[model samples]
Target: MPPSQELRRKAVNFKKGFKLKLEPEEIRKLEAVVEKATDQFTVEVAEKLRGLRVALNDVANSQIGADQAMQAIRSLSLEIKGMGGMFKYPLLTAFAKSLNDFTKDMGVPTPIQLDIIAAQIDALYVVMGNRIQGSGSKIEMQLLGALEEAARKYRHH
Candidate 1:
């Protein structure tokens, strides 16, 4: 991230779906996304990011057909770029960065990698959501694992 608050102010990424301005209500809503989480609400926060991930996937998988996958990916990329930083999930922000970088070439994904990414995203939502709801599930565990890997792998390049 940029060191200066001014840069943070100026540097919101629309491509990743970070809104340029955060309304107080939206900030409050977002803060509620992690109200139940512990440890600075990181778990709660990542769960909130899962909502974006699912939305991104929906945008990505909007099937005109297989060819439409590229359009969806591009659209999702912009959303990820735009929102990643604004939402304050630095690790999620980094995942968006990694995805934006990896998919820039627009090659096809193997079934396994596609499976991995999609499943992990789903898992993220379940786990993070569970934390807020006072519960846990198998999917949530998997999501946590995926997040751990993502947190480790995503460097702030």
Candidate 2:
């Protein structure tokens, strides 16, 4: 099966099993834990972005390393975008898709799409970084990141 279809299937099933624990206290605790996790996830994604920048900083210093970084960025960007779509977070998914195209265009430099994508990432960086860094955007960031991570693990196989 196509990876996308398989991921969607798994996500659907997982969502179905998310019943709260029978005890009220346990359910509340679970919610809190989930919330905390969500925030950390957003920050991690932001850090990953920074890592990409660091990796790409010396594109001229080592072309092979830069190329690998770019490839990883493309893969990670796609993974992020796919999670937004699966979870019905349209805005994030839309931006992620645009970002994915942006990284892909870096290789071919075609169709004038890279510039647009770059601008979008510049804007998103401000938000994603702030949220990831405990600037009050944690919950949203974490939810998005957690969802994406769940959906993308199969890709590593």
Candidate 3:
């Protein structure tokens, strides 16, 4: 048998990151900043919606770059999904998430799929245009339900 060797151990000093707690006043100030940024969010979302429309139109027209257009749609929807709830528009977040999910694996969408996409885009426009924040009204909920159902039913087809 070989001679036994002693083992050496090293201790690691893990440093704690920045403090996560915020004072009440800090929270209020942060909320005020968020509230003031809603107008900027509106402008950004409007621009993104315009890009969505242009991409959708490209897809609808059977352009040679349909794949790129679909990619653009996916990217824009994701951006919208990420920002909507931050501005207190959870409904917008929901709709954008639905759009993002529906188009996640899409390629050369069918007429019915295009129709669904168009409806989703229109719903987004209505939410932003009307400044419908939060979860919105009963009709809006119904619309969301219908869109989600349609997306689920036709996703694989």
Candidate 4:
């Protein structure tokens, strides 16, 4: 003989869904705030660049804690990559992404690789220092292409 068991099913309660609509004024206000934040992006990125530079210097000099410095470079480059486009600086984003990608799997970089890294860092500085928004000029594009080529050539060598 088998005993019968009762099965209870509970209905899931989902809160009512409402459409999220922002009024024109609210949208304008939000845009204004974003604009202000964008203006502050330079200062924040500059600080990060300084940190990157310090790490690069450490690596270049073969200083103690070079691994930690490499990690810092990777982390800062990633952060810069993430923030650049949000502030209307796609050029900066491109450079940061290049730097981040180059350093992603690197340990202690070779001297030539270090040179490539320095060039990328310098490109980032050029972008930010000139406030070059969007995709930048033809020459900048050429520079980016050259850096990418150099990175690829020296990556596995």
lDDT tens digits, residue span 37-131, model 1: 43544544554455546544654565334345644554554564455344443434444454555445544444444554464455434434443
Please rank every candidate by TM-score, starting with the best.
3, 4, 2, 1
Q: Where in model 2 is the C-alpha error above 4 Å?
A: 1-33, 58-62, 82-90, 105-117, 129-157
Which scores better on lDDT, 2 or 3?
3
| Model 1: residues with Cα > 4 Å off, grouped in runs | 1-64, 123-157
Which numbered prediction scores highest in TM-score against the true structure? Answer: 3
Ranking the candidates on lDDT from highest down gives: 3, 4, 2, 1
- On a 0 to 100 scale, what is the lDDT of residue 24 in model 3? 88
Clashes of 4: 0
Task: Give the candidate number with the greatest lDDT.
Answer: 3
Residue-level lDDT tens digits of model 3 in 67-147: 999999999999999999999899999999999999999998998999999999999999999999899999999999999
Which residue pairs in candidate 3 collide? Answer: none
Q: Report every candidate's CA lDDT.
A: 0.49, 0.52, 0.93, 0.89
Instruction: Give the residue spans of candidate 4 off by over 4 A.
Output: 1-29
Backbone clashes per model, in order? 15, 2, 0, 0
Measured with C-alpha atoms, the lDDT of residue 1 in candidate 1 is: 75
Residue-wise C-alpha lDDT for candidate 2, range 1-157, written one tens digit per residue? 5456875566655355554445787677766765656655566557666654554443424656666766766776676666543333344555566556546646532223333434445545654544322222555556445434533432222
Cα lDDT over the full model 1 = 0.49
TM-score of every candidate? 0.38, 0.47, 0.86, 0.82
Question: What overall lDDT, based on C-alpha atoms, would model 4 receive against the true structure?
Answer: 0.89
